[model samples]
Target chain A: MAFPPFAVTVDLVVFTIRDDQLCVLTIERGEAPFAGGQALPGGFVLPDEDLADAAARELAEETGVGKDAELERVHLEQLGTYGDPTRDPRMRTVSVAYLAFAAQLSEPIAGTDAAAAQWMPVASALTTSLAFDHGQILADGLERARAKLEYTTLAATFCRDEFTIADLRHVYELVWDVTIDPRNFHRKVLASEGFVEPTGEQTSQGRGRPAQLFTRGDATQLHPPIRR
Target chain B: MAFPPFAVTVDLVVFTIRDDQLCVLTIERGEAPFAGGQALPGGFVLPDEDLADAAARELAEETGVGKDAELERVHLEQLGTYGDPTRDPRMRTVSVAYLAFAAQLSEPIAGTDAAAAQWMPVASALTTSLAFDHGQILADGLERARAKLEYTTLAATFCRDEFTIADLRHVYELVWDVTIDPRNFHRKVLASEGFVEPTGEQTSQGRGRPAQLFTRGDATQLHPPIRR
Candidate 1:
């Protein structure tokens, strides 16, 4: 018995914070099936490449961040796989989607497959119809990111290496689209084991008292997750 | 440029509680590559079938549970996808794995692809060398199940329709392989709103006081999650 063959591809949903808004990287399709339409950067996987390696390779190519050091900071994981019979018009394709979280990243350089690549606010991007089933994939990624912030130290990924409690709180506010009590947020962050470690340095604004700076802690999961 | 064609298959890690121990469904392979070795029940995805539909179909076939009502009670979800180049020696095959949580289920009947099917204790199953990369897949599935119980109302899926607080707590203890204080466990479960709903019924076990009976709640996630 012969099973039908499939073409496996990898699509990336790389997210970052820009100008206090959650943003995702997107590319304009350079060739048909969806030419000129905005879509997540991806392509067919090489025959022998691992699924995760294929995702990372796509991320590097689309972002133009060729250095392993820069890519290492980006938290990447398999979001889900999309394989509707008609998701791809041309062939039977199964797409393994990856979700990535990174601090502010440099402008993306379009790969050979994409006409143009740029960062777009998630809100505005959602309003536009993306090429393929990318709109659904982006929404799923956003939901995962929002939920991850409540239980993981992932919010720190959107901040600088050394940041104040307020800076981290702001990331939560922007991603969750709600205002959080600063004092409560501060208490929770400190209480959660290995969530953050103080740098023993302080940063002062123009008027308020200097705030202690901290770096992301070694622990990835929050024991008592910070509830939304 | 011609890309290599690959075969996509679905593998299930169906878990349940039996004889006070957590068990998983396994089948003895009847084909080459790992003939006679124990493996998860699954098969190739058809050309036009959805990925999830393929998984459900495989589950139905292996268990011989033809009724949809019976299948609906089982909580199934995508675990992850494994596509290591040589994971399958016969060819390059990408396996989309799924994890399922179920209460006590009827004995399984071997499908055409499997020589025999039975429920094996997860502890014992992990000790043996499973076929292909199934051992790794099973480990990942178990980790997902353990972590899910902490934040989601997934533990309820391992219980009967009506159960006492102790019944629910036992599910946690058995799955986590830990002894939890009954009083503390009760308090946490009640505090986590929407974790369970009182059925206004009581069950008298042996000489102990009649414990209140409860059913799975409408909420799928705990707000202040029950921490481990």
Candidate 2:
């Protein structure tokens, strides 16, 4: 017995902190389906692979960054699925886009199929010619990431594992494009359970006050969330 | 130059209020790809149709609910797209699933393709067999719906244009599965800008004490959002 064949693909919205600004990983598709145009790093999901595995694989493959592989652990999750009939010219495909966030990648590789791979600021990514409905997908991913910071204390993911409150606050300001009230922001961060835990250690960037260092909070969920 | 071929599909996750609990519309698949199993209503997206239009079309075809054919507009939006090359059994297909919130459907007609269409409560829906990863999609949709209530007064879309605070509160209870303090909820509702406004009317409800009625407020967003 045979079923109507299905096509599954993985698109990666890999975001990294570049010059303190959150940017997304993008590639220039060297082939058709908007060939030679800018697009999210993605490709087919093989039969033996799990959906997430496919995304991880496509990400590494499209970026061509990890011939040797970089971080084995990158935060990746299903963003959403887009399957507009006219999205691709060849066959019917249901593309599941995954949103991945990394602290920062320096020597990231380029995909064999890509003309070039680079991290573009989200603002700039919006204006470029994207291969498919990728522009919309990127917008959704960015919105989700921004909203996530409100309650999840996920901004710390953008910083090194250990950072100061000032460093974390800067992430919020950069991502939200709004300067938070430093006093209020500091109070709120400390008050929220599982938001952050202060480390006794102090940073040597002592030109100003020796800022206190901290790590991610113990709690996974935030209550009465913080929003801009 | 021809665009690379793509196979497009539409997956529908229909949410309805059943027994004051959030429920999802599901179908018993008649054929393969998890044949004879319950699944979200979906099919291959047809060319010459937009992604949203395809989802709307699938909703109509599978559940006998169509925007044009019916008087009440179905609250529909792009939930996101899922394209993992192996999600479907046949070939490469990209699927865009729509998240639709229908308050109380007066007419729920099952189309010929599906064996049956039923509103399964979320509690038990998890245990029952769904065709594929539709369960994950359904869960994400519910989570999105729940999160949306925090910042945006979108719950009104689940009710008629004019509703009482009690009705709005009921929506919160149903979606969140948590009881909210009435007095506190009232105060919170009033505090958040553009959440609700007095309709200058009261609902008799065939009772002694009339309840104040309200309509959806302005499009202002919630700051320090209410978490579920």
Candidate 3:
């Protein structure tokens, strides 16, 4: 039986922490269907390209980041797929959405199909009307990131290679939009096995004593999850 | 830029517990590509239909179940999407996979494209070489179901509307293939707030004294998760 033809695309939600706030990478559409409107940095999936590779390529093209170097520190995974019949106006399209977490990233450069590319604070971005179903997609990505932080060690991806527990707590605080007690967070981080490994190094936040440094551990999941 | 045309399809991995063993629904293909081989129940998405609607339609058609009645008791969610350039020999097909859980489903009847439809033990199904990357899809669905059971109250979907705590425990033991201590399991389930609600009813199992009956609770996620 003949089936309806579809045009598959990949959309990205690349998130990073900057200025103590969570920001997402977005592009200003240069083409029709939402010209001059904000949208996630992504494009059509090449016929032979793998879904993940397509996401990486789009990330590199839109942000001017080298796939090899930048992706080394980025934690990328499939968020979900969006295929509402009326989601896209051009034609029958199915978009596979991916979520990525990275530490402080460099400035972005606009791609061919984008008028501009830049980081937008998630709070303000939610208020602005985004192109297509991107507003819903971005909201879903944020929720996934927040929930994963409760049981996974992914928050470490938002910090430098060597960071103090305070730096890590700031990541959770900013992303979750909550103030977590430093003392309680420290105790819980230490109790969860393989959550962090001490680097035996020390660093000081201005006006504070030197604090021990640590790096992400091998365990990807925390047994006794830190509740949100 | 012109992109290669693609066909999008939906595949299902419906799972249930029967006779103390976890089983999955599968069908034998009636057409070429993998004629007479075992496969999941699914079909191509209609031009104007929603992705989820396509999945539910396929499930109902292949299983001979009414969409309204059967879907009321089934827990269905998107598992993931698969799109290897060479996954399908005839065309470039991208399949969105779905996973479902039901309680004591009725016997399945064959659909138009299927020569036969029935339940197969998950253990044996894994050993059989299923048509088109289905083996990998099945494994992924199984893993998702097992992990969700750890944190979600979805395991109750495999039990009757009113069941004893032992029935719930059995669902876990059979799916995880692990032997959990009965007393410890009982205490943990009750301690997890809103995991289950008492029905003020009792039922007898064999020669054992009457056991209190309960139904699924309002909570979806379990705190201090029932660790695997």
Ranked candidates (DockQ, high to low)? 1, 3, 2
Flag the better candidate by lDDT, 2 or 3.
Answer: 3
lDDT per model vs. reference? 0.89, 0.76, 0.89
Q: Give lDDT tens digits, candidate 3, residues A1-228.
A: 588999899999989999888999989888878998999988898988888888888887877665567677788899888999999988889999999998886654657677888889999889989999999999999999999998899999999888899999999999999999999999999998898999999986688788999999988998778778
- Report how far off residue B226 is in candidate 3 (Å): 2.3
- What's the CA error at residue A10 for candidate 3, in Å? 0.6
Whose DockQ is higher: candidate 1's or candidate 3's? 1
Q: After superposition, which runs of candidate 3 have C-alpha atoms over 4 Å from their true positions?
A: B191-194
Q: What would the per-residue lDDT of candidate 1 be over residues A1-228, giving only the tens digit for each residue?
A: 488899999999989889988889999888888888899998888899999999888988888664668876789999999989999888889999999998887654657667888889999999999988999999999998998998899999888888999999999998899999999999999998898999999997668899999999999988777777
Query: Which should have the higher TM-score, number 2 or number 3?
Result: 3
Model 2: what is its DockQ? Answer: 0.32
> Model 2 over residues A16-37: C-alpha lDDT tens digits?
7888777888887878768778
- Scanning candidate 1 chain A in windows of ten residues, the lowest lDDT window is A105-114
Worst 10 residues of 2 chain B by lDDT: B1-10
As a TM-score, model 2 comes out at: 0.83
Q: After superposition, how far is residue A113 of candidate 1 from its true place, in Å?
A: 1.8
Q: After superposition, how far is residue A92 of candidate 2 from its true place, in Å?
A: 4.9
Question: Which residue pairs of candidate 3 clash?
Answer: none
TM-score of 1: 0.93
